[model samples]
Target: MRLMTIFIALLGSVAVPGLAADVGFEEVKITNGAEPPLTAGIWYPTNAQGTSHSLGDFTQTVAPEAPIAGSRLPLVVMSHGGGGWYGSHYDTALALAHAGFVAAAVSHAGDTFDDQSRVLQLWRRPEQLHRLISYMLDEWRWHRRLDAARIGAFGFSNGGFTVLVAAGGVPDLSKIAPFCDVHADHDLCDALQHAGVERHFGSNVPASAWIHDSRIRAVVIAAPSFGFAFGRAGLSSVRTAVQIWSAADDRHQPHPYYDEPVRDDLPRAPGYHVVANAGHFDFLPPCDARLSRMRPEICNSRPGFDRATFHDQFNADVLQSLHDTLP
Candidate 1:
């Protein structure tokens, strides 16, 4: 694990230079069904130039210690992929803040590598995302720094599925046949059932919740997991505009998962982009040298795509879409 951490850090240090900026970070602890809590990293543009700020070891806060001048900046709630932490998406968050939006990436209680089992982590992810959104709305209102009407969500992999559900793109968990054989007694299966993923994750929310709530105005999903095909009822329930993008060579979830179903069910308001030679990990900052040294697979996957190039273009596309869509 130590090696893996170093690998990811090295990746970020090397690859992030081209896209990185001075984004400030802060910690916000939210309840995760249990009392003493889970936390998230809130990244935003800073007022100070050149100077850097550090939140703590557990939390990687960077940039100017002072808050920047901005009123009602559009807010984006980001969800990292499986086995990831809030700091993992620093590049994305910083990019968005520099582009003029405040980005908050939640460190899901059960999903992060530090504290939770894989199964429990996967199961609790979607609910955590919703709760985070609800909590952020209140925070935004009180802080008066977020434009509630211009909220957006962007996520990758499992986190991708989180935003999909938030955006009203429902999946039928019962029908989610796993490609790899997982044991029935496995925590993964148990957690999946506990979360009621079949009922909520891929399926649309109730009509009442869908039509009345306007906090989430748009969504962007990258290599979203879960089947892309929306049920007839689910497709009809979607009200928010969406932007979907995926790599042609995504080794993790593949294009078929989303491409086919979205083509048939996604409404006309949503936009789609495909990166010709990208892979799943491209969306994340590079793996640090330590991890890459220990596990080569962590750094480079089955060949073809250049992770750095893919992400550079993907990040630009995401920023552009949000700027145009979010007020």
Candidate 2:
């Protein structure tokens, strides 16, 4: 593993710098009058050199608040999974920045690691992302540096469900109870029990809550939860191109339950990839020592799997997919 990590670093030197220059990093508190300030992290290309810096437990080479280097750069708004934060896909964000795109990830309020109060309220997620895109294109300090027409989205797990809706797919949440009743052995059912979520999570959510933004030209979704809910009819309206990913051995949001339905139901054929020997949480980056100790479940891959190596290809593929659609 140590040797593989060294190899990954070496590859970064050769694999990075894909369509742009050095990477810049920064955080923002988006304050729109209609909602509480949102916490977000952004990565973009820069002409300035960046030094290795610690952001909480993780470290990355980033030019902090460096001057914007590119004009009208492509923008990608990221939505993290339930109980995840903006940094959940930090490595991917950095890769996007290195590839000349501005990547912004939001710590979905009330559904983040620090709070799960709105975890079951899936309808609000796409709306949150919509607001995020609006803030980036209209209010962000670097708003003028972005190209609104080339906007895209990337999401994982719950976030997967989110970007799909934002791209005009509607999920029939009413399918939850019936599905759960039959698949009671699934981890999603167990998670719901621990989180105290009622099966009636779909009730009373007006159609208006599922906001759709046609501006998101493309999306990349990984192991989306609640996939069954997006039946053929529900996913019929999604015209935006998409790239879908699934872990072959995912234990959490397992097969035919999560990624399958979306892949099968989407009106347009999506670019899909399933990683062999990968688990559900393997979609996250290779964990740091401290993070591994704290959450080994999400950190460790199967005996033979190498996450650091896989993410190299993963990031490149994600980058290519975005550029193909957004450009």
State model 1's lDDT. Answer: 0.61
Q: By lDDT, who's the top model here?
A: 2
Separate clash counts for every candidate: 15, 0
Model 1 TM-score?
0.75
- Please give the distance, in angstroms, between residue 182's alpha carbon in candidate 1 and its true position after superposition: 14
Q: TM-score for each prediction? A: 0.75, 0.93
| Every candidate's lDDT | 0.61, 0.86
lDDT of 1 by residue, 202-225 (tens): 233333332222467778887776
Q: Which runs in model 2 stand beyond 4 Å of their true positions? A: 1-18, 32-35
- Compute the lDDT for candidate 2: 0.86
